[model samples]
Target: MTESTGGIDMDEDSSGTVKKFAFINRKAPYGTVYALESLEVVLISAAFDQDVSLMFIDDGVYQIKKGQGTKGIGMKNFSPTYRALEGYDIEKLYVEKESLEERGLTEADLLVDVEVLSRADMAALMEEQDVILSF
Candidate 1:
């Protein structure tokens, strides 16, 4: 049996099948539905007691940029939700070092704490997951 303070529980009857989920977000926020949908999936997975990790690459890095204002674009901002991941027991967040540099961004530009990884290291992380999902 497996149980944690985070609220989900898995017993031996389930075969201890907690899978690693790595969500790769590569889209910019507020253009389409990718970013929001990806966040929703991550929360749902985490609530179901799955091991979850989130990665921001390409323009996806913008999704977690601090000080986002959607009023100019007539949209409601959802960036703040990133800060709540830890409350759901999902704390693994990764950002691609190359992607941030390519866009003139630094780790300080992000709203959440994330491990900055080189492309090679990021690839190694992808290899460690049982499931890989890309937004």
Candidate 2:
């Protein structure tokens, strides 16, 4: 059985079953802690040997956008962290095409490479996830 600490299972290998974990990010990178919090949780889940994926929709796309300038707002830019996700073996990243079009952005505007999916396709992907944590 997995050992629990403060309600979180600390044993990464206690469960032999590998579950697909999808993190849906729908908020902007800053102004709120949701984006950063989601990123942290995704890393933790990946470390647990779970199949992890991140979906960026709505303003969440901004989290991985390149050329982000947070210094003017007294905040440190964390966009580069998204690029490092590959080192953790957590690579499945998706962005909603509609969201990018609405914001006048394209894949080139993103810092890390991500598959651009249509709203319908994104929904289909979400349905395949064993667990979804939205932020």
Candidate 3:
């Protein structure tokens, strides 16, 4: 028995079941809506008590890069939101190591703490998600 409420699926039979949701972010943060949209979705899933994790790969790694200057772009910098995820119990954030290396960035360059995973490990993590939402 599945029901839909406010855009969220509710399974009567598994009322308390927690679904593992993975938000895969692959775009650069400033120029597109993908990063912001993904962040909002992650917060929404977390509010539902779902197990939510975020993986930033490719240019998405720039989403959390430290000292983002959006002033020139006339966009509000949303990088700080990543730090607040811990308060919502959405702490499982991962970044692709290869992506970071290719971009000449290191863990210290990110605004938030995250587990850096190899491409192989990232694939394994994705396989464990009950729902994978790519942005």
Number of the top candidate by TM-score?
3
Between candidates 1 and 3, name the one with more favorable lDDT.
3
User: What TM-score would each prediction reach against the true structure?
Assistant: 0.87, 0.88, 0.90
| Residue 110 C-alpha lDDT in model 1 | 93
Q: After superposition, how far is residue 40 of candidate 2 from its true place, in Å?
A: 1.0
Candidate 3 has what TM-score? 0.90
TM-score result, candidate 1:
0.87
Q: For candidate 2, lDDT tens digit of each residue in 1-135?
A: 122111333476757777777889999988899999998887787778888889999999989889888888998788888988999998899999999999999999999989999999999999898777878
Query: Could you tell me which 10 consecutive residues in candidate 2 have the lowest summed lDDT?
Result: 1-10
User: How many clashes show up in model 3?
Assistant: 0
| lDDT of candidate 1 at residue 62, scale 0 to 100 | 91
Ranking by TM-score: 3, 2, 1
Clashes of 1: 0
Model 3 misplacement above 4 A: 1-9
Residue 13, candidate 1: C-alpha displacement in angstroms:
7.2
Best by lDDT: 3
Report the lDDT of model 1 for residue 25: 93
Question: What value of lDDT does candidate 1 attain over all alpha carbons?
Answer: 0.87
lDDT of each: 0.87, 0.86, 0.88
